[model samples]
Target: MKKSLVLAMVLAGFAATSFAAEPAFLADRHVARGASCESCHGVKAPAPGAKVSSTACMNCHGSLDKVAERTKAKVPNPHYNHLIGTDCQECHKGHAQSVNLCGSCHNLDWKVP
Candidate 1:
């Protein structure tokens, strides 16, 4: 019984931490601007820990071709010259800090929001 109690407590703690780590949707600026969960997450709420696909984001944002054209002038255009291809989530996070994937190899100072 004691072992079971301890295991239950541990599991509960892990569950709490996992939920806490997920960003609050309402607090996101995009959501405040009237973007719903479906705007990025599709029609259904994703299973716990499921990610929003790049295609969903591109639906509102633009296709990879459009993005590449817009940023073509930038030296080493981030969109087209990226090591990870056109997966926006690789650098952008709607509810978290965006990373500069280029920083992994190049020292370019790009401001990633």
Candidate 2:
């Protein structure tokens, strides 16, 4: 009986702690604001007006053109695959908290020195 009571208390405490943990998907401010690209990607959307897909971001930002010019060094085209099905928010996150987005793909440890 005593063991069971202690187990119940421990379970309740664990549940409370788990609920307090913050989820990564919930950290995006753009999603919270409801201004997702779907607003533009939806049916009857205008050209370059409603939908701002990653392809759109790449039309100019892709091929590392901008990054190369800025840093004078070639960078990987990380957004190419992301344009197929995901949004800018998939890896690059910003809202309630800031995170290291590019670091996910461009590992500093693997960078050619």
Candidate 3:
């Protein structure tokens, strides 16, 4: 390929990649509090779309009871819901927007931030 064509292809590749890869949305929240990828994921490099277990989350966030207590004031506590033992990742997306799974079925006015 001509040099100009090769250069154009490289630049196009970079632009495509930039649009495809979103910023790690939740990284700043935990990283600012002295957490790293290894600290949370328990690996130096967690594979793309790899899930961090609830056990890993509880390590720093305490038990389910503790989480429920923290949200005690919120009526129909999310942590103490019918889906009590659900994995933390169900509603908590590390790199994407967090969701209120409870609101999926019910018309609850809760935000999962």
Candidate topping TM-score = 3
Candidate 1 per-residue C-alpha lDDT over 1-113 given as tens digits, one digit per residue, 9 for 90 to 100: 69999999999999998766654432275665777888888865756666778898778768877877888888888877636365777777766677788877888888765
Whole-model lDDT values for every prediction: 0.73, 0.47, 0.84
The regions of model 3 sitting more than 4 angstroms off are 1-24
* TM-score of model 2 vs. true structure: 0.27
Give the alpha carbon lDDT tens digit for every residue of 1-113 in model 2.
69999999999999887755534443233345554544434444345324345554455456444533554443444433333344654544333333445566657332211
Task: Point out where model 2 deviates above 4 Å.
Answer: 23-25, 28-83, 88-113
Arrange candidates by lDDT, descending.
Answer: 3, 1, 2
**lDDT score, candidate 1:** 0.73
RMSD (Å) per prediction: 11.0, 10.8, 9.5
> Can you write out model 3's per-residue Cα lDDT over 1-113, one digit (the tens) per residue?
89999999999999888755634456557776779998778998999878888998899889999999999999888999779999988888787888888998999977786
Model 3: pairs clashing at backbone N, Cα or C within 3 Å: none
Ranking by TM-score: 3, 1, 2
Error of 3 at 85 (Å): 0.5
